[model samples]
Target: MSPAELAARLTDPALRVVDCRASLQSVSAGREAYATGHVPRASFADLLEDLSGPVVPGKTGRHPLPEVDSFVGKLRRWGISRTHQVVVYDDAGGAFASRLWWMLRWLGHDAVAVLDGGFAAWVAEGWPVTDETVSEPAGDFAATPRGELLIEGRELAELAPTARKVLDARAPERFRGEVEPIDPVAGHIPGAVNLPFAGNLRDGRFLPPPELRARLVAALGGTPPEQAVVYCGSGVTACHDVLAFARAGLPLPRLYAGSWSEWITDPARPTERGDAP
Candidate 1:
C-alpha cells in the first residue's frame, strides 16, 4: 500500500503493521532504529529472533527459517490474526520487509503485503512516525507450512542445469564471484543468473507492474516461473526478488532458503565462477 493509503487507515483496528528495518552488517542497528522512530502503531520484528532461528554454524545457513510452532507464538504476540491485513516495511528498499511477506505466505496467510517503497519512502512523504513501542493483545494466528515455496541447497543441486534457472539476487560483484565479503564461499551455484534485487525498484518504490514484469522476464531469460529458483547469500534478499515477481503479477518462484551459504557447506558440490555462460 502507498503511504497515503496507509495514513488514511492508520487508525484501522485490523491493520497489523510491522517494521522490518535491519542491517546484515550490524545486528542491533534495526532495533536501535526502531527505538528512535518508526511507522506509527508498527511493532518491530527483529530479523534474528523474529524472522529466523538460531544459526547452527557450518551445519545450517546464517538465517534458518524459524520453526513454525514457535513462530506461531511470535505472530500471536504481534496480534497478527490470520485475517488481519499485515503490512511490513523496511529502510533498505523492501529487502527485509519482503522476508516477512514471504514468511506470512509460507504460513498460509495471504492477507499480508509489503509496504511498497518501505520506511524510507514513508518518511520522504512526510508520514508521521512514533518512537513509542507498540504492544498488542494476543491474537489467533496459525501456521500451515507451504513446503513447496521453499527449496534447500541439496534439492536445488538435484535440478539439472537444463531444467532450472537459479536467479541470484546479490550485487553484480558478488554474483560474478569477484568479491568475498560475508560468505565463506565466493562463487555462486552453477548455472545461476545474476538478477540483483535492486533492479526491481526505481527511486525506492517498485517500478510499475508492467515495467517490473519486463525487467523480471528479461532476467529470467525466457525461463518460465515454475522452472526458476531464486537465492542470495543466506537467502534474505532473494525474497525481494520473489516479492518483485509477485508485485509484477507473475507466479512466484521457490526460494533456496539455505542459498549460497548452504550451497558451499560441502566441498563436493560444484561451483562456477565468472558470469553465467
Candidate 2:
C-alpha cells in the first residue's frame, strides 16, 4: 500500500501506529512534540531508548544493537505482538522512522511498514491529532531474528568487491571524505557509491515510483538491486534508501547497520579518500 493509504489505516483497531521521532541530540523534543499533538491513539517510541540497546566497548557505531533480551523486552512492553500490523512515522520524512521499520523486519516481523511522508504529510492532509497521551496495554512480542536482513562490518568488508555494490546514503561530502562531524573516522566503507538518503525525497515526500526507479537505476549504473547493499552513519538513515528501493520496485538490499561508525572502529579496515576507489 502507498504511504498515505498506510497512514489512513492508523485509526484502525487492528493496526499499531508508532511515532518514531526523536531528535538525534534531544529525546525530550520528540516527546514534547508528541505531547503537544499526535495521531489519535498513537504511542511514542524513542529511537535511542527503544530502538537501540547499549553501546558495546570498541563498537564504533553511534548506536549499537541492544541486547536481544532487552530489545525483546521493549517490544513486549510496546504491546507489539506477532499478529499486529505495526506502522511507524517520524517528523523527518521516513529518515528516522525507517529505522523502526527495519528493526521490526529484522526481528522477523514483516507486517511493519513506515508511514510514507511521515507526520508532515499526516498534518497536511488535515488528519485528526490529539493532545492526550495514550498507553498501550502490554502484549507478548517474541523476537525471532532474521539473519538475512542484516550485514555486519566484517560481512560488508568481505562482500564489497564480488560484483556486489555497496551504497552509502550519507552526503556526498561525507562519503567522499570532505567533512565529518559525528564519526571519529572521516570516510565511508570502501567500494561504496554515494547516494545520500535525502535523494529519496522530493518536496518532503518520497519521489513517485517511476522517478524513484530512474534515480536508483542511475545510481547503480544499471546494476540490478540484488547486487546492492545500503548503509549510512550508524545504520539509521540507511533505511531511507531501503524504503526508496522498495518503492522503486527494486529488490530489497541488506542493511549494514554498524555502517560507517563501526567500519572506522577497526584500525585494519581499509579507508578511501578523494573519490578514488
Candidate 3:
C-alpha cells in the first residue's frame, strides 16, 4: 500500500508501523532522526542493535542477520504480532527497510510491506508527523527460520556457477569495480550480474510489479527466479532486490547473507570487474 493508503489506515488496530531510519555511517543516526519527528504511532528499530547480529572479523560480514531467538524477542518488543500489518521505512529509499522486510519473511511472516518511498514520501504527502514516541505492550510473534530462503558464503561457492544466477544489488560502479567505498575489495562475484537496487524505485516509490518482472527477466536471460541468488555489499540492500521480486509476484531469490564483504575475505575466490560478461 502507498503512504496515503497507510495514513488512512493509521488508526487500524492491526496495523503496526516501524521507523527504520538508519545510516551506514553512524550507529545512532536513525534513532536520533526518529526522536525529532516520525509518523504517528511508529516505533523505532535500530539497525545495528535491533536488526543485525554482532560481526566477527574475517568471519561474518557487516550487519549479520540477528539470531532467530533474539530477533523473536525484538519482534515482541516492537509489538509485532503475527497478524499485524507491518510497514517498514527508511530515508535511503527502501535500502534499510527491505532488510527488516526480508528478515521478517525469512522468519515466516508474510504480512509485511515496505512503506513506498519511505518516510520522505509519507511527509511529502503532508501526512502528520510526531516527535512523541510510542510504546505498545509486548506482542506475541514467534520466528521459524526458513532455511531455503538463505544461503551462506560456503554454499554460494558451489552454487554460483550453475544453480544460481547471482545478482549483485550494489550500484553499477561498485559492481564493476570502479569504486569501493565500503568493502575492502572492489568488483563482484565471478558470474554475478549487476542489477542495482535503485532500479527497484522511481520517484522514491517502487516501480510497478510488471516492470520489475520485465527488468529482472531481461537481466537474467530468462533464468527461472528460483535459480536467482541476490547479494549486496553485506547482504542488507540485497533484500531490496528480494523484496522487489516478491512484489513482482516472482519467486523470491535466496539471499547471500555475507555477500561481497564476506566473499572477499578469502582471497582464493575469483572476482570479476567491469560490466558482467
How many clashes in each structure?
0, 1, 0
Tens-digit per-residue lDDT, 60-168, candidate 3: 8888888889989989998999989998898998999999999999999999989998899888889999999888778999887889899888888866386668999
**Model 1, residue pairs in steric clash:** none
Model 3 misses residue 96 by how many Å?
Answer: 0.5
Estimate TM-scores for all models: 0.98, 0.91, 0.97
Report the lDDT tens digits of candidate 2 across residue range 1-277. 3456865776676687788887877869888889989877678888788777667757648777777778878777777789889888898978888888878877888898777778878888877889887777786888889777677888777764756788899989999989997877788777778989898898778889899999888888767786678888888999889888878888878888888888888899998866735
The local distance difference test score of model 2 is: 0.81
Better of 1 and 2 by TM-score: 1
Query: Model 2 off-target regions past 4 Å?
Result: 1-10, 222-224
Clashes of 3: 0
lDDT, residue 165, model 2: 82
Candidate 1: lDDT of 141?
A: 97
Candidates 1 and 2 compared: the better one by lDDT is 1
Residue 268 shift from truth in candidate 2, angstroms: 1.3
